[model samples]
Target chain A: MYYRSQYPRDLFAELDRLQREMQEAFDFSPSIRGLARGSFPAINVGGTPSSVDIYAFAPGLDPASIDVQLEKGTLTVAGERKAAEVPEKSTVHINERFGGAFRRVITLPDDVDSESIDAKYRDGLLHIAIQRKQEAQPRRIAIK
Target chain B: MNMNESTQVAKAAEAARNEAAMLPPVDVIEDTGGITLYADLPGVPKDKLSLQVEAGTLTIEGEVALDVPQGMEATHAEVSLPRYRRVFTLSKELDTQKVNAEFNQGLLKLRIPKAEHAKPRRIEVKLT
Candidate 1:
């Protein structure tokens, strides 16, 4: 006879909680939608069998001030962008630059190698390289 | 051609030149320590972005265009538009090594770290 057991209800509840948190964390909606006052950061995620690549478009922000964290298959990016310097005696008619505190989070399914992750910034773009988990790569075995 | 006709031609050429000179707007702010600059440059790629600092001013230039392909007509474009160009003056306390910048979405973030001498520090106290 074969014995089978189902997952505990607490474990299922925990999984549900995590899913809710993930949904809240990765919301891509802007605070002021359809308004020209702010520019929402664009993001791209690409992956191969052995690696995953994430790109964030953020300019004029101090790299040191920005923070990136990954936990429980979730990626969180947060930072504060200072306002651009303006001359004392200049009057401006139109202002369309975005400045303030901003935060973005994403949930990833791929097993990312946090230790091997690499981040690079150039021309105002942040590129993150995440090595895929070894088990996530497909393989074949010969039968004896 | 008459002198008036030649003058009109020159005026027309000058107007064309002005129309073609469409540079993005920029703002530079100077504080007691350093300067901060903000530039509006949409659709600028990392390879095309360049910054040059000569004399006392820093110049940032990037080329961006709405690529509608060879035979395609522009129906609508609301994502990104044109290019951005801006410049700024650098101060002495602005540490170039610590100067950090990032660009997300379409916003450019630049931080000119203050010099060691300019940054605030706290003295530790020892009790006997």
Candidate 2:
């Protein structure tokens, strides 16, 4: 495993590139670590029969600054987490929080209805729900 | 090399790797009077966060509640850990009894003041 540097930002970028290549090679899915590497804010994608749900773990950010875009069956969440305020003349022992701009893209299933989407931000978690196509939903036909 | 020992070693390494993913990043700042600590705890609400100071030790624990929406099951998930845990030993010079904490926008801020006795003092001298 080769890493560019100890800084989390660069390290994550390296992992992201690696993961993208792997994804193309083997159709890999993001995990907790390894391919995912806890990039900036972690993301989770799930779905129900009627709608697709996406939960993005983005903390310490203003909801107004976040940009959400849905285009061509792809959803993108982009935002910047401002650096926390630190008092002057203080000794900083440990600083591990990643600060700066970040963006995440999630590709939804083809059945997802692009017209209907709902998003909310609460407790640092951004949740997006997109309705599925009516024709794609599972159906039980009455016995004739 | 014992085979069982090697297996145990691999398991320990894997556990460490997994734990690192869950460890919340924290910043500890120390000034003359005391120390201020900040932690990023996303998706954790006030009811789910627990901060405890016991026997000269401070522990921060936050649990992320993933409320699966009604009739929805996760199809793909990247974040798996539900809890964040971190522990630290406080300096004896600091007053543990008076610790202030506030959580807003998923960030936890804690301030621990220095003990009264630990403050700097100067003595006065008179000419004889």
Instruction: Quote the RMSD, in angstroms, for model 1.
Output: 17.9
Instruction: Give the top-scoring candidate (lDDT).
Output: 2
Error of 2 at A16 (Å): 19
For model 1, residues A60-129, the per-residue Cα lDDT tens digits are: 6677887888877777778887665565654443344556787766666557776777777654556666
Question: For every model shown, what is its TM-score relative to the native structure?
Answer: 0.46, 0.76
lDDT of 2: 0.78
Over 4 Å off, model 1: A1-39, B1-37, B40-128
Residues B1-128, model 1: lDDT tens digits: 99999999999957743332224444545444444555655446766666666665666666653322233333212222244445566766677766566655445556565687986567889899
Question: Candidate 1: how many backbone clashes?
Answer: 19
Candidate 2: regions farther than 4 A off: A1-34, B1-21, B120-128
Computed on C-alpha atoms, the DockQ of candidate 2 is 0.39
- For model 2, residues A22-84, the per-residue Cα lDDT tens digits are 674467554423444457677888878898989888877788999999999789999898776
